[model samples]
Target: MVTDTAFTWSDAKRECRNMGGVLGVPSSDEENKFIGQLADGVVWIDCNDLEEEGRWKCREVNVEVAYRNWMSGEPNDVDDEDYQQCFTFMYDDSSCPESWHYWGNSCYKITETALTWSDAINECENLGGVLAAPSSDQENEFIAQLVPDDWTWIDCNDLEVEGIWKCRDDNVEVAYRNWFYGEPNNAIEEDCAALAVATWGNK
Candidate 1:
C-alpha cells in the first residue's frame, strides 16, 4: 500500500522486505478490500509460487493461502509458466494480456514493455514461464531467429554473484554461452543481460 512507490511484484515485495515488512498479504476478505482501496493502482501481494509450480506461499509469513480474491479466469497457468504465480490486488481486477509463440515444447513472448531484470523475471513467471532461457544450442538458435525488436531481455544474469550466470527460472547455472565479442565485460553497472536483437537476429 505504498502509494508513492511503483514496483513490479517482486520488487514491491523486496521493498517491503527492506522495510522490515513483507508486501502486505491480507488474511481476511475485509482486510483484502481495505488493501485494495489503499492505492488507485494494483497493489502487489505477498503470495507467489516462485519455487514450486502449483504451490503458492505467502511472501511475508510463509503461510499457505487460505483466503481468496482472484479475478475470474485467473491462475490460468498461462504460457506454461506454471511456477510464476505472484498475486496482486487492484481496487478493480487486472491481468496482463499475454501473447505467446510456441518454440519446441515451450511458449515464448518478449514483453511489449520493458521491466528491470527482477521485474521481467517475475512477470514472466506469473505468466506461467520464466524469461526465455534457450537451454540448448538449437533452442538458442531458434529463439535468435524470432527477434522482432532491436533488443529484448533474457533470463541469465550474474546479479547474485558476478562471473556466475544462472537461469532465473531454476537458479541453474547456464550450461551454454554465446557471448558477443568482449561481451559481459559488464562495461557499466549493467548486471542484467539479454538477447540483443541486433546481435542475435541471424543466429
Candidate 2:
C-alpha cells in the first residue's frame, strides 16, 4: 500500500515494521513498475549496498534483488557522507531534494558560493556529488540552464595526464566534448575544464 507521508528510508522501514509489514522489495520488473506507479514519487525500497560497495541486497527479504532497474548513471555512490547506499524510485523518475533540479534520473544544484574548479569538485563531493558531467548535447543544455549567465565547473579534467580529458567520477575518458575553437589550449598549463555559454574550455 502507498502512503502519502514522506520519510527517510530507514524511518519508512521502521514505520512499516510498526504496522506489521516490511518495506517493499520488488522481485520482478512488473512488480517494481507497479510499486513505482502506486507511490508516484520517491518511495524507499529495501535495496541497499551498505554491506558491500557494489553488491546490492534487499535487507527485508535478506536476498539479492532478483530484478534491477537503476536509472542510468545511478549507484554512483554520490559521496562519502551519505554514500547513496539506499535505493529510491519515482514513477516518472523526476523527484529530487529541495534546491536540486532533476534531469535524466539524476539531481543537480548550482553552488550558492563561487569556487575555483578544484574547490568546486570538493564541495560537490562533500555534498554527495561530483561536478556535473554532461554526456550529451541535451544534458549539457540542461546543466547550462542551471547557471545560464555564468561559467560552471564540470567533471571533465586532464589532471591524470596532460592532454587526456577524463571524467573524474570514474576516471573514464570523456566521450563528449564541446570545446570552443583553440580552447583547451592548456593556456598557463590549466588542467581543469569549465563550461561557458554553450562552449567548453580549460581553466
Candidate 3:
C-alpha cells in the first residue's frame, strides 16, 4: 500500500503495523523497482537501528535480506549522535551526511537572487506560495541549485522565543542547523533569520 501524507519514521512504522502489513522495506532489486514504480518521493522502509550500534530497532527484522541503495558516502554516521536512523531513497547534496546535523526533510524554492527572511517569505507568498518544504531528494537537489556561494535566508526563525528557530511557513522544527555551535544565542539585538554560507564550515 501507499500513503500521501508525510510521517516521521516512528509514526510511519506504527501506521504500517496497525494496517496488518509491514512498512514497505523492499529487499531485492525487483522489490525496489516495484517500490519506485509504486510511489514517488520519500517512502518509509523496514530498515532502522542500522548496525546495532545502539538500540536501533525498526518495525521489522530482516537481517539476512538487507536492501540498500545509498548514494556515495552515505550512512556516514558522523558524530555518532543518535542510535535512531531513518533512510530516504533519494540523494540530495543539501543533505550531505556531513551536514545532517542541521537539516531535515524540508523543501525550498529558489528566487532569482538572495533576500532577507521577510523578503523571501513575501516573494513566496506573493506567488501564492509559502517557503519551500522539500520532502524528496529531487526537491532537495533543486533547492541546492538555487543556493549561491553566498548565504540566503530561508523562511525560518525562532517563534516561541527569541532563538528557538523554525521554518516560518509551518513551524517545522529544524532537524538540522548549520549555525555556529554557540551562535544564535538569541541576542536581543539580532533575532532575525538567515542561512549559512555554503563554503563555511559553520554558520
Candidate 4:
C-alpha cells in the first residue's frame, strides 16, 4: 500500500524495506488488483529467478499467480551456458524480458539498508551472503513488478576477478549458472557485470 516515485529501483526498494515492506510482490488476483489500484506506472515487485531456473517464487510466501504477463520469446535459455537467466518487465513493451534481451531493465533486492551497489555488496559479504540470487519463479515475478523505466543490477557478478562470473563469496557451485547468447564476452574492458539498458531488439 505504498506509492514511491522519483527513485532508482534500488532506492525504491530501500524505501519499502524501511517501512517494513521488502518491495511489493502481487501474486493472487486480490493482491494484483490491489497493487494495480494502489500504484501507477512502473513499480518494484519482489520477483527474481537468478539462481535456478523454473523455480519462480514470490518474496512473500503464500502468494498466488493471478497474472502471467511475459514478453514474447521470453524465458529463453539462450544463455544457459552462463546461467545468467533473470526476469524483469519493460514499460516500453509488455513482454517477459530476460537479462540479455534487455540488461538494463533488471532489478535487484538489497539485503542491507545501503544506497550504492558497492555498499550493498559489501554489506551482503559481511553477513556471509553476497546479496541474493533469484532461486525461484516467485522471485522473478517479484523482480518484474519492481522494474521501472531504467536498468538495474542484480547481485550476480564476477567479483572474484574480472570477466569471470561467480556468485557471492566465490562459491564454486555457482559456476553452473546460465547466461544469454554471446554474453559474458567481457570485451576486455567490460570486466564488471551490468544489466543492459536498451531493449532486446535495440541491443
Candidate 5:
C-alpha cells in the first residue's frame, strides 16, 4: 500500500491508519528489507526521535525502535539540526560521485561550460545524471545555492505539451513550481524553464 504522492509525516501516519494499518515500522531485518524494497525511494516510516533526541521511537505504536539500520555516520544529526530526527529508508548505501553534492538521496553538480537547455540535458546524461530537476522548495534552494547569482538549467519544460511542464529526467509531471510573476507566459512559444536569480521562468 505504497502511496506515491508526498505527504507530511503526520499526514502519512493518519492516512495509513485510515487504511487500517499503521506506518511501516520495520521491526526486523526481513521487515526492513521488505519495506525498503517496497519503497524504491526515500519514504517516511514510523521512526522518529522528536520526543527526545537519541531516543528513537515508533510514534504510531508508541514503542522504541529496536531494529536499527542507520546509514554510515547517519543518525549523527548532520549539521546538528534538531529536527533531523525522522527516518526514511532505501537500500542505497553507495556514495555520491566525486565533486558531486549529495542531498535528499540525489547527487548534483554544476557544469563548467554553458549550453542551451537541450545541450545541457545531454551534458548531464553523459555524466550519468539528469539536468538538475528540483522537486521541492528545499531542493530548489539547494541547487540555487550551488551556483548563486546565476541562472541554472533544470530539467523542466513544457515542450511535449504546452503549459504542461515536467522534469525530463524522469518525465514526471512537475508538482512543484516557483514561477516568477507573469512568467511561463510561453512568450514566443517558449518551452524550456530555467531558474533565473532563484525564480523560475520560461523566458
Candidate 6:
C-alpha cells in the first residue's frame, strides 16, 4: 500500500515496512495507469535499479519485473545531477548493518542507548523497525545472547489491558512470557516489558 505522507525514497520504504507492507508494485500497464491517476504528486511505485543501473526490478520483490510501464525517454541515466539509485516507489526488503545479527528471519539492532519505553520504541521506529518481538524460545534465545544482563525494550506490553500483555507489532496477546523473578506486578506505573538484567555485563 502506498502512503499518503510524502517521504524520501528511504523513508517511504521504511514507513511501509513498519506497517507490514512494501510499497505498491504496479505490475501491469493498467495498474500503472491506475496508480498514476490515483496519485497527486509522484507516488513511488516498486521500480528500482539498485543492483544494476538500467536493469530495473520491482523493489517490492527481488525478482526482475515481468512488465514495465516507464515513460518514454524516462530513466535517462542522467548522471552528475546526483546519485539516484533506488526508485521513487514500491516495497523492497532489507539488509541491516554488519553490527546487526540476523536470527529467526529478522535482524536485531542491539544498542546500548538507554531510553524510556516510549522513546526506545520511537527510536527503533525511526530506524525502520520496531522494538524487538520474541515470540518463541529460539527467538528469545537470540535476544538472550544480545541482552543477557540488561534491560532492553521488547514488544510485549500491558498497554491494552493491564496484566494482559500483548505484542505491539501484531496486537495479539502473548501466549508465552518470560518474566523476571518476582516481576510484572502490574505496578501502577508499569505497562511496558523489558529484559531484566541477568548478570550485568555491558550495562
The lDDT per prediction is: 0.61, 0.72, 0.52, 0.46, 0.72, 0.61
Model 4, position 26: C-alpha lDDT score? 52
After superposition, the stretches of candidate 4 with alpha carbons farther than 4 Å from their true spots are 1-116, 123-130, 161-163, 169-178, 195-203
**Candidate 4 residues 48-84, lDDT tens each?**
4555675544555446444554447754656552221
Over 27-57, each residue of candidate 1 has an lDDT whose tens digit, in order, gives 6554564454455655667666677776766
Candidate 3 global lDDT: 0.52
Model 2, which residues run further than 4 Å from truth?
A: 1-94, 169-173
What CA root-mean-square deviation does each model show from the true structure?
19.0, 15.0, 15.9, 18.3, 12.5, 15.5
Candidate 5, RMSD to the unseen true structure? 12.5
- Using TM-score as the measure, which candidate wins? 5
Q: Where is model 1 poorest over a 10-residue stretch in terms of lDDT?
A: 82-91
**Which residues of candidate 5, in runs, are more than 4 Å off?**
1-94
Ranking by lDDT: 2, 5, 6, 1, 3, 4
- Tell me how many clashing residue pairs each candidate has: 6, 0, 8, 45, 0, 10
TM-scores of all models? 0.45, 0.52, 0.38, 0.32, 0.53, 0.47
Instruction: Report model 2's TM-score to 2 decimal places.
Output: 0.52
Q: Of models 1 and 4, which has the larger TM-score?
A: 1
Error of 1 at 99 (Å): 3.1
Tens-place lDDT per residue, model 5, 16-49, is: 9898888877665545544554565667778766
lDDT for 113 in candidate 5 is: 91
**Per-residue lDDT of 1-203 in model 3, one digit per residue for the tens?**
77788887678778887888767665544345445544567576765555566443433444444456654665566776332232334434354343221223333345666576567778878855576543334333334445745555555566557656664345454454445456666666555555443211212
User: What does candidate 6's lDDT look like per residue over 20-90, in tens digits?
Assistant: 87777755544453344345556666666766766766744455557665455667867521223223222
lDDT of 4: 0.46
Show pairs that collide, candidate 6. Answer: 23-91, 44-88, 44-89, 45-89, 45-90, 46-90, 59-91, 60-91, 149-197, 149-198
